[model samples]
Target: NLPFSFIFFNGASRLYRSEDFGKTFTDVSKVLKNYYIRKEFGINVGPENSKKVILTADVSKLKAGGAIFRSSDSGETFEFINLPFHPSQGMTFHPSNPSQLLAYLTGVLCCLDDVNARGNLHLQRTTDLGKSNTKLHTNIYSFGFAGQFLFCSVIHNQSLPRSILVSVDQGDTWNEAQLPPVSHEQFYSILGADNEMIFMHVDEPGNTGFGTIYTSDDRGILFSKSLERHLFVDSSGANDFTNVTSLRGVYITNVLDINNTIRSVITFDSGGEWRALKRPSNSQCDKTAKNPEQCSLHIHSTYSISQKVDVPVPPLTAPNAVGVVIAHGSVGDVISTLLPNVYVSDDGGYTWWKALNGPHYYTMLDSGGLIVALESHPDRAVQVIKYSTDEGQCWHSYNFTNETFMFVGLVSEPGAKSMNVSLWGYKQENLYKTTWLSYTIDFNELLTRDCDERDYVLWLAHSTDFGSRTDGCILGCKERYQRLAKSSVCRNGRDYELSKEQAFCQCTLADYMCDFGYYRVGNDEKCVEQSDLKDKVLEFCLKGKEEQSGSWSRCGVERIVEGQTRPQGLGLD
Candidate 1:
């Protein structure tokens, strides 16, 4: 059973906690008797432990600022945090450590009144549940953590070149990153692939029409330009940047290509190179098209979600993952077409096939092991539901009910990688009355056993016809094979039943990582340019030979290895 869920809504400051999933509610607003609560409030639950809940609201309708109340034990009691400035909606909690919080300090500079009150966002950090707070940075636009490093972008600094600040020891010390030459760059934010790689979006200097994505592998110490294009950034909230990379290192982002058009691009090797995804097979392209590669398609983007702009478009309300894509695209220039048939991409958007040829609500479960869809066409009542275990290659059908209902959404746990899914909609029993209902399904009871050989197929870096696959061709200097599966996994950590063929890969560009003091700039062959080599040092090898030219050889120089091999499972530098 779940612990508890709380809500404060309906134009009332009344707080309610439900232990039985809305069966009955307990009013916990009394815990905040010390300070007056307001209808406008921001509530957050501790990411690690749900019991730790916190809220912020104006102290009173006539008060100048607001008060923050935090409760370590759900809503039974609340402790008011003493801070100088009012906390804004921008609050970030450490992922693993729930007690630490970073919130934007507001309502200070020119607030004079709640309305027409504008103030600079000063970043504040607290580790002791707001008992004490420290102002870390001022006028910071956004902040996120990569490994142990904390990054914040400085915005609206007229005296200084706008820059990003990094803190190695939490917020104790901060340093500006040695970013590549940038100019007239308007946006500043960070994108991380799970917490290891940091992708920075900035405008390259002397460039007029495009932006570049620079990456840092060792936190923010060294950097390299990974990709350059008019990459799409989601305007969901105040965040100037959003992530397109998934857990399996599959990146799906719409880029302005061919004519500054929205062509969805994907990359399997970090950002070494990117290729535009083909349009769905069912959509007819123009007959005059020279080739399929030049054909343009409008890729569906996860639109403004925090503002709830498109409630019917699914919002992708799921964590980014690999092997399954609920892509919405039209033949050409369908920017206004919000809904199309569901296009499935199992091979990381290399190719796509239409699975559902209508407007629909979609969700993925078990890291794309299961795909669910409910038709919500404008003219039709929703009843039929379809699901697939093999990434939409095949499907099984189920009816919603004997009668049709208005499809609201398909719901599931995001990033939890769970097998539970829920179907939600409103049933119209009479012309004047409607009933909201939700039916949940636990796949544990339905999926009886593990998948078999039929669930897997040998996967490669690129697509190939029956006989077009090249043997031992240097494609990203990858391992022998990639096993893609419709099933989550087999005992062998992959569901592909085929045997791996042995092949020794030559030292391709992928095998050689960026050299010290140098970084790659859209160039994959070698790390040919210098970055901020911040006090970089070299270690003595078995005493150093071939790479050590001139009289710097401590060991034998005859026939010694000169090349360095990239470590297994490292991202493209």
Candidate 2:
């Protein structure tokens, strides 16, 4: 949430700021009185700390570049971070620290397709608020952090066949993550998830044709193939990848089989395992002759870091999301008279129930506690915005505007934490004229109260039992087990705290990740060490090293070449 009530609006010639959470507004445009606001602009604030704010926009300047205005007092005053170029992307503030920022000094773009015009980019950062800067890299494809590790994917020499360079020492030194060898045609980009886990989808030819999902729980030391031909999409050059794993580390994907039928699958243990979701028990059409049946479901697209370019990708969803998910599909073998509708699932896609009778452009609000959608009809004017606080089973409608408007998009600000929704679209004044406007719907004013007991529901994880672990458990308990949490919450749910105690899980792989080049076989408890581990695995795996601090700080390099002598304290014996 915002410490100040300042709500900033771009694209209106002048920028507006409201401190009252969009309740009221003031013209803060005078702060940047010297330049014009370009269509591409960014406004960033600290996540949960000081009142530092940054506003960057392409301004009409003498040098024909963008301007970045920084404010330490929450926009009360402003200063400039003079740069030769403006970034198309936003300033990424540190998750905990505000004074620190990660930004790129990119070159100018002549047009939308100026893919190469990013101007020999310098990925830089400023820790002392522009007093000093450090260039992290140049011409990187993308970069992100996993726990203490920093990963930057780069298309080598500005070409295909990218590599994810890892920096374990705050970018002081870098090494390439030993990902599965990929072909030139294969586009392997990282997937999004929570915790210190990495998921990558490498495109390969197969009947499913989705791509192979490779994962690294040990933070880029090595990767093992997890799910093949699963649901994966690189929304903005792979930024908005996957169904954007939700509140409980849940990943939902629609696996399109050779029959062109999509079966919904979800993974709770990262992509280590996957299970098909049962069709909504009460689905109206329940036939199995052709495609588009109850199993022929489609899901929403979620984002990790969305690029700000215009691309005809799936509808984007960022949402300070949670586990409550929604899908749209039919129950009948669609060779018949079956139509698709919205279905709701609270327990990570194990079971689902119908929510909306028709396809709708929907999103989760109130932290996955409420579901809201604009009925998806491209040719008609939208009159009502519907929402469901009792999960997706029941919904209520709110007229966002006095008259119908042609819907372009509905977006909930990432962390505003308010029911305030901004709906923008075209209001045709006549056959010859249409005006664009936005309506701010503060659901706090529309609804009577928070969800009550009738909306309270319970669901349990289907894959909580870890009977077989490759990382043999304490070596004493044989019939190891896991505590399955039957999560129950009101319409507005909260995460149930599970027992920290691994009650009965014995000799299970739950306690340990397959050590270094070792991985557990499918549903088996034995950790199978890769015979070719020397070539691409850890050079300082804890299990293989004598100096084991259980951290990567004390690490070594992998120099396992054929017919070469092993380094001291680093042999495959």
Candidate 3:
């Protein structure tokens, strides 16, 4: 089990560490000082040292920020690691080396910016924990580790299709990995599994609702088509198969027939072969007068004859277990009354059993074969949260007295203490005000008692830092985006404007005048004029073309010159 885990709380302004599972937490914000960790970038733990935590902070003019911090002695203390670039995203440590890190310098170009400005996006690699770094590539969409090999999906040129590149020598050199002939322009979901197996799902062109799944066992050196159909693989949430074994992987497809019933399939041999799973039967529904026989008895025979049933695509799979769960209803003239609300298949999707009788949203926990179900009813004021172990063979329900608590998600750490889960929910106190809350539950203690008799302690905390008054601001604006007062107007470009009604607004330069509290950092980008710039800082500037002269200004940074054709590594000392 994991010895310790860290959580970013209070809107990532504060960090906490828990050694005894979710029992208690100690504020480790002092180690991070005044820098607020960027929750979106994610906090990474050292592969070798669980206590060695890495987190990135937002860079501002006032604070000494925009750097990565590492805690060698857990959260007690931290040391700053020099980053070649600021505002990095997707920071990941090597699976075998804690000192190796990979991150992309993002936010270098805005959405409205030209594609040529994309050269600023650099995928950097560091093997000595930021002591030195190398620019691996540019325009990287995503990257992950498959064993000792590092894989990256990058789009070198906007006109060309994205390429899959692999680096086996700790990102020192890269080789183009062979991918399927599917359109490389579409979005791809790449996952690395155990035994050096890499799986990728390339979306088909057009809205065919089908994609091709490719598998590579040679560490992405060669890939072969595993499945080519309308396969719906549950790759989101906690069920991600990136770092897990491919034996328990499950996906959904349709049996070729006139009716084309959706079928759940499981692959245990790293997607070398797949076997269709049987649909679950409901004995309770069979005993009813309307249906006096077992549903499986009739359904299995009918499936053999008609080869059609109303089964939805993409059956939900358990996070770490060999389980496949699905829900469906009758379609067209087929009046099948024996169908249960939910069916679950364990044992690598070989057999199945009716799990639940009513509609509910299912969420599989990371451990203990646990799954939670939230009631799906628009009219219901109070909803029930159902917990089940043993692959949903039995379930216990807990009703929420607070009607405002809406289920959001479950947070569980890999290799965490078993049966320790945290439930996130959104609480709307009123129409205008909303809050995010979380409840940490220890299932081992709660499952010991009966469903009704169980009285477990729920440690409640604010998932979002609502108490913080500081709001986010953009480059050209020094006032908090939420601030109602406007001090200055834009002379060259339009001042970024935000209304009280809009939750978010984009600030773009129509002309070049800096708003109050902000000044032109270089020639283009604006920063807080009052910020303490003690060292040399890279600032975004505007370069005008000869023809467009005063008519157009290209918003770019000094590092990205106007006519530079190649990406240059940032000089960091």
Candidate 4:
């Protein structure tokens, strides 16, 4: 019983056979001659006879395109299955039947006789594995099976109605699937699976507004919604297609406006409820404290004395929430890099935990504990990613020879064996397989190697450590100072060397503090920074009192209130 084989395209398309479940492989490139530009490959271990094989190749030998190669006798010989030349994105064999095959080109899915092609979406099916061609659809970006039906979405078209549609009885007809109200722009990056659920990410239009996640069950007929408040700017905020693992009823998509905001990655639960895998909120308070509001004072006052000292203050706008978060897996709970150091919520955007100590960029498995991370350090050009165990209480690091973009990604599998830490591209080719170790034991051994030959190592610990602590919340005249100190300036500072606990605390505080001109003058810690004059008043009031070395009377109104306060009048002006 051999495991799956692996193939890749570096300078040219190359093939390899891994006899030991991807542990070791021997090059079989000699068999694939002139395999220049490879698009995609599909392999199916024959059911009846394990030796029987079928290989589809997108040999980009010519500028226009390449050829699809098929092999039956264990790669000993090959025959070219002549097909139309176009970039192929996916190819697969039917799960129930080995003889049935399907492949997707840029705009078409072709089969033997039944060709259903639209101007936009292309859907195809083959009764006799790559023997002939038939086009099914050409309207949707991508689609998949949904029981006896098909589900999919229209490709990138801002004008098109951003909606998921379903087709029963092959590609003969179509109907819009039930979905929550969202802008059409969000429809660009839609995908579906066979599992009867679809997820869509929607980016709203506005100045720094959040996006929404929409999910559907019953083959995209009805939908549920979840709001995501943070904006993630990755790949133009498009929903990444790499996360979903299920097919049929389950599909995924992310939404954002034209400005491109990575709002949220959501998944549909078994109950048909839209579950947010990652959600950001303005929740920074001591959970155990009976009265967390007692931590701060928000006194909203406006004393206008234009011969009218009894004037009242105007109404204030509601406080806005804060915090930024990104989900790791396809439909995991929302995790925040804000306070309690860092927090994770497994209950699909319901409750949260103060899981870690620092704001992390990469969170995965390592030799010791789970890894939480922080942003890259300017000094350490090579070491950007970091890992932590015990829920981000501590961390270990490794420095790659090359700068792999600092981030955390799932290991493209479950069971927590190992995870991908980063993705790197070289001048000659792209290195996507490189990964980081999840187990603490594996990481310790990985470090013992030369650790420099590879262009990039995508593991959990190869990055640096980010020591952090503290829940981010502060209220007072010195809030900015408190915030700056709580941020990387303090967490990554020379003082305590940015212990993971300290970093987490600082991040929490920084997240909840003011920006200097406005204050959260309410009972809630929801506040803004004081204005310069107010700050000056606060600064001088505190300074004058200390300088006078006495009570308010000794400090005197002239010295304490006159020069220090923003307004210059009698008692408070």
RMSD each, Å: 7.9, 8.6, 24.7, 23.1
Which ranking of candidates, highest TM-score first? 1, 2, 3, 4
Tens digits of per-residue lDDT for model 4, 1-573: 233334465655566654433344577767666554343455544544445455556554243433556666655455666555353554555544556556665542343232233225456776655666577655555565533456566644545554556665455566665443345433322333344344444555543434544444333443433224323233344223322221111112333334542223333222122233332232343333334433211111121112122212211111010011222211122211112234443222233344334223343432112343544232332334455533333445655445443333222112222322332222222565554322112343433322121322122110113232211211101111111111111011112110111111111221122222222332232333334434343221221242221123221111210011222222312
lDDT of 3 at 113: 60
Model 2 quality (TM-score):
0.69
Q: Residue-wise lDDT of candidate 2 within 59-99, one digit each (tens)?
A: 54346455577877777788876654555577677553456
Q: Give the winner by lDDT.
A: 1
**TM-scores, each model vs. reference:** 0.70, 0.69, 0.56, 0.42
Q: Name the better of 3 and 4 by TM-score.
A: 3
Enumerate residue pairs that collide in model 1.
none
What is the alpha-carbon lDDT of model 2 when measured against the actual structure? 0.53
Give the C-alpha lDDT of model 3: 0.47
Ranked candidates (lDDT, high to low): 1, 2, 3, 4
Whole-model lDDT values for every prediction = 0.54, 0.53, 0.47, 0.35
The candidate maximizing TM-score is 1
Tell how far residue 46 is off in model 1, in angstroms: 3.5
Q: In order, how many clashes per candidate?
A: 0, 13, 7, 93
Superposed Cα deviation of residue 201, candidate 2 (Å) = 2.8
Better of 1 and 2 by lDDT: 1
Query: How well does candidate 1 match the true structure, expressed as C-alpha RMSD?
Result: 7.9
Pick by TM-score: 1 or 2, better one: 1
